[model samples]
Target: MTCSTLWCALASLACLLAAHNAFAALSVDATPPYIKPCRKSDPELNQCIKHSFEHLRPYLIKGIPEIKLQSIEPLRIPKMVMDNGHGAVRVRAQFSNITVIGATNYTILDVKGNVTTYKIELALSIPRIETTGSYEVNGNVLLFPVRSRGDFWAFFSNITGSGKIYGKEVIKNGVRFMKTEKLLVDFKLTKSKFKIKDHLNGHNVIGEAMNQFLNQNSNEIIEEMKPGATAAIGKHFKNFLNGAFLQIPIPVWLKD
Candidate 1:
C-alpha cells in the first residue's frame, strides 16, 4: 500500500477512537445511578427520602418541647383491682397536682388502654386574688379515650379536648356574701387493663394506680383551660405530667 494511503487510514482510526471515548464519558456522567435531591426520578428515591429526613433531624427535634408533670397524689380510691389473665393485681394510685406555671397552663397527655370507657367527673375552683368570690368551673361528662401508646407518641406529644363551663353564681350568709360556680365534667375509662410491664418499667408497675389518676386528672385540667391559652401551657403541662408519671412504682413490696 502507498505510504500516503496508510497514513490516512491511521488518522481515521484515531478519530473514531476519540469519538468513542467522548460518547462513553458523556453516557456515564449523564446517567449516573446514584439518587440525589435534584434527581427525583432516580431509582433510589426511597434512600433520598431517608436522607432528606436525616438532614431535617435537627429542625424537627428543635420544634418539639418536652413535658413535665408536677405532683401526683391519690384522690378518691387508693387501690383498684385488675385481672389481665396473667393473674390479678391490685393497683394503688394517687391524683397528681398539675401546675403549668406560665401563661399557658396546658399539657400534652396520654390515656392508655380503655381510659375513655369509664365514668369520670371533674370540679375546678379558681381562688380570688383580690375578690371574695371564687370561680367554680364544671362541665358535662366528656369521653376522653386512652389511645394506643405508640400512636399517641407519633403525633404531637400533647393532646387537646373541649367542654363547656357553667355560669358563675353567688351566695349570701347572714348579712355576709359568698359566690361560687359549679360545672359538670364527665369522662370514661374502658374496663380493660394493660399489662404493667407493657406501659412502664422499673417501679412503675406498683405506681400504675397513681399514674392512672395523674393521667386522668391532668387531662381534665387541660380540657378545662381556655382554648387560646393551651398551646403555650401544653408543653409545660406535659413536662410536669411526664415527671409525675415516672414516679409510679413498677412493683410494690408486700409486708409479710
Candidate 2:
C-alpha cells in the first residue's frame, strides 16, 4: 500500500475508536439491577435496615417545631376543693422534645420496579415532655401559672406503614428525582406514663393538686390525645424517612 493511503486509513480507525468511547460514556444500560426482596423473615436484611437507620440520626432528633395534642374535654369534678384556699385548676397541655431511644421491627414489604415499601417500629423516649399551655381556674385557687414539665415514657409500638421512593435506576437525561407518596401509617401509643412532680414554686400542696388531677383523669387524657399524637408522629416519621433516603438512591441504599 502507498504510504499516504496507509496513513489515511490509520487516522480513520483512530477517529472511529474515539467516537465509540464517547458513546459508551453517554449511554447507560437499559436493564435495571435485580433487587432481592428484603422480607421480615430474612434476618440479614432486617439487620441491615436497622443498622442503616444510623444515617438518619441527625435528621431524627432535629426537633419538630410543634406537635399539638388534642384538647381535654370539660370534666365534672366532684366539687373537690384544695387546701390553703385553692380550688380546681383546669389545664391544657402540649408536648415537645420527642426523642427516640431505639428502633425495631424493620420489615421490607415489597421491592418492585422503582418503588420500595417498608415498616419500622420506633421506641421513642421523650426525656422532657413539657405538657403545659393554658390554665383555667374554675375557683379561687392561687396556683403558680399551672405550668408543669414531666418525664413521659411512651411506646410507638410497631408503627406499620410503607413509603414510595424513586429509585436511581430510573433517572434519565440528567433529571434528578425523589418523591414520597402518602405513607399510610397506623400506630398505637402503649405503655405511656407521666411522672408528675409535687414541687412547684415551693408549694408542694399546689403541685399535689395538679398531680392528683392528672392522675385521676389519666385515661381520659390519653384517649383524647391519641389521635392527634399519632397523626403528628406519622408526619414527622414520613418526613424523616423521605429526607434520609431521597438523596441516597434505593439500590445503593439497599446494597450499602
Candidate 3:
C-alpha cells in the first residue's frame, strides 16, 4: 500500500478500537440482570418494579418501637449573636431524641450560648432507604440548632405528627457497592408544619411549610450495614420515624 494509504488505514483501525472499548464500558455499567429499566409500552415493567420492591420487603415490616433516652452532659456552649447586644446566656439542658426501626439514631446536642440556636446530630444505619419498603414521617419541626427565639418553644409545642410510606431506591451504587451515589425515597408527609412561640410573650407564630427533598449519599445507613455487622435495621427505621417526629409540630396544650 502507498505510504499515505497505510497511514489512513492505521488511524481508522485505532478509531474503531477506541469506539468498541467505549461501547463495552457503557454496556458493563448498565443495570444488571433482574434490574433493567422498563419501557413505557412494556407490560413487564410493572412486574419488574414489583419484584424489585419485593426483595426489599424486610424494610417494610413494622417492628416494635424502641426508645432510648440519654442525657448529654453540659458541653462548652458556643457564643451566639442575638437581636439585642447583651451577651447570650448559657442554658445547660438535657438532650435526647429517639430511634425506631432501623439501625440509625439522632440526638439533640445543645443550644448555642444564646439559646436561640440548637444543634442536632443524625446517624443512619443503612446505606439508603429500601426501594420496596415505605416510610412516612409527619410534623412541622425539622432539624436542630433551632435558629429563632420562638423556634424552640414552637418546635416543642406544635409537635403534631404522622408519616406515610411509599417506596425508595438506590439510583447509583458507587464502586464495589460501598456507597450509594444517589439515594431516593419516595414518600409524603400528611401534616408537616412548625409553630413558634414568642420566647417572652408566649404568643403563637407559625412559620413557613415543609416539603420533600431527595436524600443523597445515605452513608449513615451504608456504614451500619458493613459486612457481618449485627446491626438492627429496624431500630434504624424507628430512628427515622422519631426523627420525623422531631420535625413535626405538636399543639401547645399537648406539650402541657
Candidate 4:
C-alpha cells in the first residue's frame, strides 16, 4: 500500500473509541460480552455508565484482548518533549522510558453525554500519581542556565480533572460508526514533588538545588507546561479508545 493508504488503514483501525460514557456505551448483551452498555433513554444514564467503567476497570488495568487494550498500570509513555516555555522556566527537555502509576485508582466524579451530538464530558479525581523516567534537559530555569541528563522521579497528589470528547458519525458499508474528531483534557495537582539524579559524577549540589527549587515551585512549572502535557495525554487516550471502537461496531456499543 502507498503511504497515504497505510495511514488511512491505521486510522481506520483506531477509528473512534467512543466516549463510552456518553460518547461510548456498548450493549450489555452485545457480542463483546464485556461491556455493560447504558441505555440512551435511561434517566440515570450517567451514573449507570460510571458503573460500567467501574466494572470494566479491572479488565482495562490488565488489558482486554478482544478489543486490544493494553494494561494501563504503570502506563508507559515512550517519550515526551517540552520546549514551549520562554519565561522564568524557559527550557528544552526530552523525557524517555516514562512509566506512571495510579490510573486505576481514578474516582469518577461525573459523566455527562449526548450521543445525539456525539459529545462526551467526564470528571474524575486521582489521589496520587508516581512516575519515573530518564531525561535530558538544557536552557534557563528560574533564570539560571542549566544542563543535565539524569534519571528522574516525580510524585503528584490530589489531582482533579475533566475532559471532553468530540466525534462525528460516518457510514461505512451502510453501518453507522463514530470517528473521533477531537479531544480536550486538563487537570490540577494539589501538591507535587520532583527529583533528578545528576548523571554527571558527583555534581550533586546543582541537582539537589534544582530539585529543591522544582519541588518548591512545582505549581508554577506545571502551569508552564500544562498545555503540552494535556495535549499529549489526550492524543494517547484518543488512540487507545480508537482501538476499541474500531474493533466493535457502534450498534454493539450503543444502540438507538
Candidate 5:
C-alpha cells in the first residue's frame, strides 16, 4: 500500500487495548493471578477497576490460556480495510498480516465506569505502537494518485486516547453476561513515521517523494482514515469482547 496507508495502523490501536480494561471478573481472592477481579460494591470501585488493568497487563502480553486471552504482543490482525472519499486526503486501503507491537505497554491515566448502567470511559497513554504488514490500496491522496501492493512499516509515539464502551446485560442459563453494544474511540499522536517498500513501479525518486509527502501530511492523512478505522476496530473488538465476556460470567467479576 502507499505510505499514506501506514498511519491507518494508529487509528484504533489504543482503543483495542483499552477494551481489556473492562475485563475484570468475579472476586479477587478466587481468580487466577492474571485476572484481576473488581468488586462492584467497593466504595472506590472505579479506581479498583482501573488498577485491575495494570494487574492484568503482564498477562495480556503473552496471553492467559486458562482465560483464553491470546497474545496481544505483536498482535495479529487478519485484515483491515479503510476508506475515505471526502477529505484533503482520500484513499481506500486494505491491510493484512498486520502485526502490531506495544499495545500492552500503556498507563491508565483515568477510568470512569457505572457498572449498573454498563458504561465505561477510559483515558490512557501508550509510549508507542509499531506496525508491519502487506496490503492492497488504491486512491488519490491529496493531488497524487496511488495504487500498489507491498510491505509497509509505521511507528507512532506519544499516543494518548480516550474511549467509551456501552453494553447491556444478558441472562444465560441463570448466569449474567454483558454484551458490548458499542465502543467509541478517539486518539492523538505527537509524532509518526511511515515507510513502504515498493510503490509507483519501484521508482526510487517517485517513492521517496511520496514518502516525504505522506510523513509531512501524516496528521491530516490519519484524520481521513479515522472514521473507517473506528468502525472497523469497534466491530472487531465487540466480537472479541463478547467471546471473553461470555466465557467469564458477570457475577464472577461484576454484581448487581
Candidate 6:
C-alpha cells in the first residue's frame, strides 16, 4: 500500500477503535462517537495526523508484510480443520476456487479519537472448496481421507463489532511516549445462506453421510466461523493502526 493510502486507512481505523472502546467501557451509556469534519488545513487535527503518521511509519511497515488477506480471487487454504459436537469428529479441508462479492463495504458511523464504530456488509460465494483431509470420529472409530466440493453463500446485516487500543506511556530522552494497546475486537453473525453442492470420495456410505451432515448443519457451521472472520477484519484494521500510531509518538488527542 502507498504511504498516503496506508495512513488514511489507519487513521480511519483509529477513529473506529476509539469509539468502540468508549462504548465497551461505558456499557452503552456513552454517546456514539462521530468523525470530526476537518480540512487538511485544520491546524490541530492535521498536524496530529501528519506527525502521528510519520512517527508510526517505522513500526507500521514491519507488520504490513505480515498482514495477509486474499479477498480478490481463488483464496487458497493449505489446510482447514473443523470440529463440532464436542470433539466427536473432525474434518481437514483445503479450500480453493473461491469467488466473493460485496465483502468489503464498511459504513463508518462515528470516529472519535482512537476508536471507531461502523457497520460492515459482507457476502461470499465459494464455487468449490475441495476437502482432502482425513476425518476421524470418536477416537478413530471412523477414519478416512475424503474429498468434497462445496458451493456456499453467506450474507449478514448490521454486523456490529468492536476494536480497542491498548498501550502504555513512558519517557525516552526526556520525551513522553505512548504506544498502541493490543487490538481487541468483538463481533457476531445473525442469519446467512450456506449450502453444500456435492460430495466425492472413495467411501460411498461415509461420503453420503458426511454430505447430509453438512447440508443439514450449514447454519451451525457458518455460525462457528463468524467470530474468526470478524476478528480477521478487525485485526486488519488493527494492523493499520499499529503501523500508524505505535512505533512513533502517540498523538496528543488519544492521550485523553
Question: Which candidate, 4 or 5, would have the higher lDDT against the true structure?
Answer: 5
Q: lDDT by residue for model 1 over 1-256, one digit each (tens)?
A: 0001011111111111111121122221232122112232445533443343334333222321211111111001121111111112111111112111111222212211111121112211211111011111112223322211110000012122321222221222211111112222222212111121213334445335433643545444323322212322232223322222222111110000
For all predicted structures, in order, the TM-scores are 0.18, 0.40, 0.19, 0.80, 0.84, 0.38
What ranking emerges by lDDT with the best candidate at the front? 5, 4, 6, 2, 1, 3
Q: How far is 50's C-alpha from truth in model 5 (Å)?
A: 0.7
Instruction: Give per-residue lDDT, candidate 6, residue 254.
Output: 42
What is the overall TM-score of model 3 with all chains considered together?
0.19
lDDT, candidate 3, 1-256, per-residue tens:
0001011111111111111121122232344222223333444533433333333222223221222212111111122111111122111221112111211111111111111111111111121110111111222122322222322210011111111122222122231111112111211112221222323233333122111111221222122222111112222233333332232211100111
Off by over 4 Å in 6: 1-104, 109-154, 169-178, 195-215, 222-240, 247-249, 252-256
Best by TM-score: 5
Please name the candidate that would achieve the greatest lDDT relative to the true structure.
5
lDDT of 1: 0.21
How do the residues 109-213 of candidate 2 rate in per-residue lDDT, one tens digit apiece?
Answer: 332222233333222221111121122222221344555444333322323333332223334246332334443333233333334343233655655665665
lDDT of 4 by residue, 14-59 (tens): 2223232323244324555456666788888788767766666666
The digit string of per-residue lDDT tens for model 6 on 1-256 reads: 0001111222333532232221122221222122122233344643443344344333322322212212212222232223232232333333333333322223333332322221222212222222122222222212544455543333344444334556556454444344455565544334333334444444456545655665566456545444443344454555555443333332333433
Which is superior by lDDT, 2 or 6? 6
Model 4, residue 38: distance off in Å is 1.9
In candidate 5, how many Å is residue 141 off?
1.4
| Candidate order, TM-score descending | 5, 4, 2, 6, 3, 1
User: lDDT of candidate 6 vs native?
Assistant: 0.35
Instruction: Decide which is better by lDDT, 1 or 4.
Output: 4
In angstroms, give how far residue 50 of model 6 lies from its true place.
19
Model 5: per-residue Cα lDDT at residue 78? 80
